[model samples]
Target: MKSSGKRGTRSFGAVELLPTWHWSQFTFFTMVDHNGNESSAPYFILIGLPGLERAQFWLAFPLCSLYLIAVLGNLTIIYIVRTEHSLHEPMYIFLCMLSGLDVLISTSSMPKMMAIFWFNSTTIQFDACLLQMFAIHSLSGMESTVLLAMAFDRYVAICHPLRHATVLTLPRVAKIGMAAVVRGAALMAPLPVFIKRLPFCGSNILSHSYCLHQDVMKLACADIHVNIIYGLIVIVSAIGLDSLLISLSYLLILKTVLGLTREAQTKAFGTCVSHVCAVFIFYVPFIGLSMVHRFGTQHDSLLPVIMANIYLLVPPVLNPIVYGVKTKEIRQRILRLFHVTTQTSDP
Candidate 1:
């Protein structure tokens, strides 16, 4: 096999293979040998940001601060929901579940990103990279399902007020949560496995500070049509379908609210404002990132990386704050919790 030695170009018998995409401009390839054996990197590098490489060290502080806030805020939500018997309703139950998923989603991607930015420890083992990818996408899907369940809870509370208790009993809510877990896990399980089977004979430096299935798949030298198709299927089945259902539920809710008295309408819509904010926070960045990855390759590469990181971090950091501020029960409980703590610690 002859070698061109430009961007690690190598001859695979009769075919001369150039690296894939513009990202190959950033790094060299270490591809398969003449025997078609896997010579891919056992570890991958996470370059934080493409255009702003010089500022990445300083960027770590804000990212780390956001991660800390996400963890603390979500934990407080969980603590309040668990301790306050009044919040044992289906709505708060789903909120608690969402908080848990938020924590998982941010934690899965942030620590490694912090390492890359703070210490430049960017090398991640192939297996560990795959694990992070699974955790992030799976938890994100589960969060979508949980949000859907919360929308349903709101629908029942506002539209079918008398039937709310009977319709969404604790057992049913628990079953819904379990289904979210199973569906998210089962659908995303093949993603990492598919990447594992593909021969990654190119630059293993990922586009973002994290390992996404889409980002990792692009590095593979083999035909990736299957990966692309399966990725779309997962998105459609999980986020896309869930989003449509949640929207439909809200439409029905709107109709119900329109028929109510003005005071009642205000009260009903107020209840959903936090959830609406949460939904937008999760989906906007997610869809933007997806579009940038699929369609905006010609645009600045930094757009996708920024959108991906926002998709991962924004919902977690903002959801808790939205709920704490918008939901009356949660806000009061948080205040009470602080009041008690302050009194207990007084000198």
Candidate 2:
């Protein structure tokens, strides 16, 4: 099989492949492979919460509320970071990036998920599914990188307080952001390529409301050794490496803090509390979801789904709250914004 050279191109042998859409449930999409050979089962049916089929209406309430909060909260963070010139430091800039990522990530999957819940619109086209999978995973990798960047900012602020400004300049931070995007895209670009080249001969039903690389991979009848190995490498090199470096940065910060005066240490450590909380919220559910996928039995199949919801939705929802509550500058800006809105709205 030839690897993908473009966004939607797939290789079969030596012939050209193209994707076409049909109207049936079984053959919703037909992909013509290298020799112009066509195969059905190019569509994926999202089997979202089979156990809660009857309760989708009620489930919609909380899920919709969370989506609303995630959007508004992250947008507020972006606004504050943009308007408040004092908040344009490296740490807040990274926070803004994280919040913006939260918005993107939340918006990417929630619309389809809400549709799946409200309208039972579970049929996702093959090409669309691949795009969703790439967006979700790439955004996740970028968020992890942003978190790692924030950890570094905290370390510098604590360890080298005088040079923090010089170390994390705006241009450097912009480069860091670009690097994060490139790293995530480069790492996950091959996932859809590999999956598309393999002939999917089995069930096309997906286990969750959204497309995940691993979940979709399980539906392939072909040997997925390359897919699996590449996924593991992506995870280790991106998220795992990020977590490790973030931890190391904090450890070094801790060591440096030991030499500071008591008051100085308290002042320095306070700035890191929000980031630590955000990290915990993100990693705990992510790790749990991974564990469920790898080791949990069919009896606990929904464990991964629930963990994924928590992993993706909770961080975005809570990160803004954590930062708003912990950082006095951010908290004040939020309050002022609300106060202005309230005063303007009075009838």
Candidate 3:
């Protein structure tokens, strides 16, 4: 029997004939050689799995639409905060930071996802993939940190109204926001560095819509036990523990509110209710993703795609609407800004 072997693109033929039984053994042994010696090559793979063509189409269309709305909505918030001097308070400044972060978080992954859906191009450069992973996580971590700061802002304002001005001054708020951004970037940047160093000897296809750390690390050739542990620690600290502290801050605020007059209590709770809702919507999906990834079936990929988009996009789109409508000052300011623009544009 003639034996054939493939090394990269070049094929080698047997110089001497072997018995059929020996050829079978040779094929098995040579397969290990192919696995060990194969060089990496880029290939286009569908973002979603096979048999999910319709699912991909349906998911991509709404995701693209949501991403656009998120971008425009967050931009409007930033513009409003920057151009309107009367809105220059600690609350609105934090809101501006949140809007900026939302824009970064949503745009980070959505554009690439839309590209994959529209063009059927899922081949990401190794460096680009690493950058994308780092950016998404960094922005997400920043958002969480910003939210915690916002909670503290609210806590001080409601619980200690007289000291609010001195406590959250412009310089102080700016410093806090900058620190949050720096902290987030510093914490998340190392993850991608570690991930990129691992050898990817298997299929390069990413199972999820975006370059998630968990999904990308699954392609590693060597052991990932330590990486997974480190990831869990990061997630627990950045997201899980942050959420807990925010919750505790709110709980203290609730106790303080309860001791006040009915009218004051009502006003305070109303101010925070929108933020509470926004936080819940933002974090529930994240917690779900973590739980599912750790304890549930990893092969079920749709859960994560849906959860990721919801966590990233929904809050950005809804935040402006929720806070703008709920707060009388912000609502009137938005209307006044629009009215002035309309008058200025009249011919």
All candidates: CA RMSD (Å): 4.4, 6.8, 6.5
Candidate 3 per-residue lDDT over residues 1-347, each given as its tens digit: 33454323333331222112221121111112333453322321326533466567676787788778878877887888888888899888988898898888888877777777776666677777888889988998998988898899899999899999999999999999999999899889888887866766555666566787887877677788877988988888888888989999999999999999999989999889877876886788777777766665655456766666676778888888887788677788789888999999999
The sequence of per-residue lDDT tens digits that candidate 2 reaches over residues 246-290 is 999999999998998999889878989999999998888888878
Model 1 residue 201 distance off true place after TM-score fit, in angstroms: 1.4
User: Which residue pairs show backbone clashes in model 3?
Assistant: none
Ranking by lDDT: 1, 2, 3
Select the stronger candidate by lDDT from 1 and 3. 1
Measured with C-alpha atoms, the lDDT of residue 257 in candidate 3 is 96
Residue 341 of candidate 1: its Cα lDDT?
Answer: 97
Off by over 4 Å in 2: 1-40
Clashing pairs in 2: 15-34
Candidate 1 residue 9 Cα shift, in angstroms, is: 16
Instruction: Give me the overall lDDT of model 2.
Output: 0.84
- The true-versus-predicted C-alpha distance at residue 56 of model 1, in Å, is 1.6
Give a tens-digit lDDT track for model 1, residues 1-347: 76656565777664445555435355444555545566656677787887776799998999999999999999999999999999999999999999999999998989889888888787798999999999988998899999999999999999999999999999999999999999899999999999888877657778788999988998888999999999999999999999999999999999999999999999999999999999999999999888888887643477778888899899999999999999999999999999999999999
Model 1 clash tally, residue pairs: 0
Which sections of candidate 1 miss by over 4 Å? Answer: 1-38, 298-300
